[model samples]
Target chain A: MLELFQGPLFISILAAMVRIATPLLFSAMGELVTQRAGIWNISVEGTMLLGAVVAYVIASSTGSPWLALLVAVLACALLSLILSFVTIVLKSEQFIAGLALNLLASGLTLFWFQTYIIGRDPPKFAGFEAVEIPYLSDIPVLGTVLFSQRVLTYVSFLLPLAVWFFLYRTRYGLEVRCVGENPKALDVKGLSVGGRQCLAIMFGSVMSGFGGAFLMLGYSDRFVPDLIAGRGWLVVVAIIAGNWMPFRVVGAIFIFALLEAIGIHAQVVGVSIPHHVFLVLPYVASLVLLAGLRSRTHQPVALGIPYRRE
Target chain B: MAKAFSSLIVGAFGSQKALLGSLAKATPLLLVGLGTVIAFRAKIWNIGQEGQVLAGAMCAYWASLWIGPLPYLIAVAVLVLAGLAGGGVLGLLAGVLKTRFGTSEIISTVMLNYIVIFLLAYLLDGGPWMESGATVAYHQSPPVNAMLEWPTLFGQGAAKLHFGFILALGATALSALLLERTPLGYEIRAFGSNPTALRFRGTDISRLLLVVMLVSGALAGLAGAGELFGTSHRLRAETLLGIGSSGIVVAMVGGLRPSGAMLAALFFGALKSGAIYMRLQSGTPAGLVSAMEGLVLLFFLCAAVATRVHITVRSEAHA
Candidate 1:
């Protein structure tokens, strides 16, 4: 156990935690916006998955990781448009709509992958490579752990702050927040509640797409079915655990990522515990955290409720 | 595309074998769908049916092992009961959390699915329940005693269909009756549509929620037992995990009605059955079937919403 915490091992674990947390951070920040705007977009898992597959397909075919990332975000934006229409325009139940979208994404990705790449050696591209900052990279522990990550990792670290500023510092952000807490007030103010919600949903989905792209282009070499796993759901949990706060949501994501890193490293180090037990550690931790912390966290008043003009 | 579509239709209904195969597939979906409908009717989102099914399967498997020496009919009955208890307990836990801790059933249920799946993996992967044969893989659980297996209801070979299909059909009728003819059924629907009103009338909402969870979980458990005794004969993750989610789609497509769920299950089951044939003959991937299911679910949700809402288009010039 003591050896497990030595200099190199500790730094490696910390680095792994950051990398693992990137996808979660991206999606959680996006979800934080959506939840803040009074919509619980449960389709984050599905949207992230769709983004991952699209990223993989585009990256392998075009050999441009940047273009793949862009396409991923745009494609998911379209997907979230469907969610927005259903939840906002049609006034459907958000949870069920999200579940339907999740299934759709899961099925669509698998079908596309099987139809196009099942038998062949699926094409692979060199994904995003890490960029080193000159002086920062020279710093011993922090350099290797934080400064030498992929460009996306650096963006992920800064995204929560950007979201924080956007939510707290902007007039539109205030309106969006109000749309969730009391859409009636916004409606009475002659503002379009549905329009604000639509933007929030789209923004959240674009972020989810970025997270999915990072998972494929920045983390893995190839795409697989169910590649996004449950990271999208973890993002939801983080939002709940963080009480819809940007910085605390990032903290929750880091804790989850830490558990995930431990799970991976435990297998690498041949820990005596059952591998499945370790695999489930993050989910168990999330449940425990949510159970304990949710009571203290105040969800938006209109979250999951469809707004009406009446 | 036309040829493939024709082949799918013919493959799903061309022969008795194909028909029975579809029925076999539909059995689990129907059972789980019934469970979902019951819970959804009460406005309870018990999305952890996947885990509850696994819990039931694991318990049924254990019960079969211990009761192997008993009379064949008695052993099967005991195994089914064990399955019900196993799944019901997990559902009850979620109910307790919701009533006591104010946890969202959706999140709690999803988390429970992961936890139960991991527990199943742990038990199967070189754990005590793993098959002991030299050639057997870690994932394979030991087959239940022969006496615990359900008797076949059709042609003897690969086309054989088990009696569990009858139980599924029976459950659909039973659930329909429970929802329409009983006071409890009335209360369930009332709770779904207006819980605050029910509370005003002095209804025990928490107790009602617990009962709904128990019944829903028991039906899902029955599905697990049916799969174990009728088809797989051994508990495995691949055989169980997707059933719960598919059941959710089935229930929604059925509009949360027992009779509707039964019909939807049969349709989806035919799609699943035909997808296998399509894969073998046309080289279309089996994943297409799942995609189709999702597409059907999305269409149904849209249709449901369209019926409930009145839409109007206005020019932006009005602003």
Candidate 2:
């Protein structure tokens, strides 16, 4: 355990944490916009998996990671329409609608994987490599941990800031927030409630898709059905534990990523605890965090409720 | 696609063996679906059926290890009770989280699912329950004692149906009664419709949540235990993992009604059992069944919304 904190190992751990946090940051930033718009879209997990599956297929077939990323996010964006339709047009239970999307996404992924990937030679694909910043890469531990990463990691780092500026500084952001805080107000202002929500859903879903794509092209070279695991759920938890705030959600995601990074390192570090303990750390932490953090203060007033016009 | 569809239909209902296999597969689904019905009706999203199912099987397996040579029926009963206790405790924890800590059941249940799955992996991989005598340890437990395996109702080999079918039928009837004819059922429906009114009536909503979760988890637990003792007869995560999600699909497509769940279970069970035959007949992957479950669920969701709209329009026209 003490050896884990030794200089170089500690820096490596921090680097791993940054890498793991990249995908989650993408998802959290996206989900925050959706939540702020009062749409509690819980289909992030399924959507992310769909993104990954699409990325895998496209990268394998077309031999272009960029094309895979573009196609995957676009597919996820289109898929969000089903959720928007059910929650917005149909006025069904938003949670159930999300649940349906989740099942649909995972189930479809399983089918496609089984039909194509199984009983065949694994497809080979080249994922993104680390792009080192010229001067910044030389700066001791911080450089390796922050500056030397896949190009997307930097975008994810700036994402929270960009989102913060949008939500707190821009008119459209204020209007989107209005849709969540009070949809009737936006509706009364002659702004379409469903229209704003639909846009927000697509944006959130596209970012989530990007997260999935990054998880694939940034690190993993192979496609598995359960590849997304519960990271998408972790993002959702991060949003809640962070109290729907942009930076706070990033903080929560980093905590989860840090735990995951530690879990990845624990066995190599000769930690005495069962590796399963590390595997479950994020989920356990989430439950504990939510149990301790009882405030729903920042939650959108109309989150998960279907809006109606009389 | 059409060939696959025809094969799926024939494989599901073509013969006595096929029909029995369908029922056998449907048993756990029916039990889990019935359990899902209870919680969903009250509008509490207990999404941890997967974990609850595993917990039930683990608990039952643990009990089986301790039980000495006893009357067969008594031993089986003990295991079943143990299964119920395992899943019920997990459900109760979620309920407590929702009521006491203000944690959402959805999040807590999802967390619990991961926790339970990791725990099972630990158990099966290396911790005590791992099967012995192989150079490489397979992630499964040694089969339960042969005497303790649930008795077959009919058929043999792959299509061997067990006592769980009877239990599932009884459960369907009980769920129908509980949701329609009883005061608790009335409260459940009322709570779903307007919890504020129920709270004003001085009802202990927390207790109700706890009860709903307990019953729901217990039913899911029974499904797991039955799957272990009746069908698989060995605890393997793969055998039990998808039943929970399929159960949810059943409950949802059944329109959250017990009888509807039964029909949906049988339908899905047939689809699953047929998938195996479909795999043999036309080289279709069994994973297609999982996709079809999701497809059916999404289609049902759209249809449900459409019908509700249709009914409202009709009522307005009548007025």
> After superposing candidate 2, which stretches have Cα over 4 Å from the reference?
none
Docking class of 2: medium
Compose the digit string of candidate 2's lDDT tens values, residues A1-310.
Answer: 6787789888999999999999999999999999999898889999999999999889989999999999999999999999898888988888887888888888888888888888999799878889999999999999999999999999999999999999999999999999999999989889999999999999999999999999999978688898988999999999999999998899889899999888889888879888999999999999998988777899999999889997
> Can you write out model 2's per-residue Cα lDDT over B175-216, one digit (the tens) per residue?
999999998999999999899999999988999999999999
Overall local distance difference test of candidate 1? 0.87
lDDT of each: 0.87, 0.91
Error of 2 at B221 (Å): 0.5
Tens-digit lDDT string for candidate 1 (B152-224): 9886655567887888888999999999999899999999999999999998999999999988988888888
In the predicted model 2, the residue pairs found to clash are none
Q: Which tens-of-lDDT digit does each residue in A68-161 have in candidate 1? A: 9999999999998899988998888899989989888888777788889888898978689999988999999999999999999999989998
Best by lDDT: 2
Interface RMSD of each: 1.4, 1.0
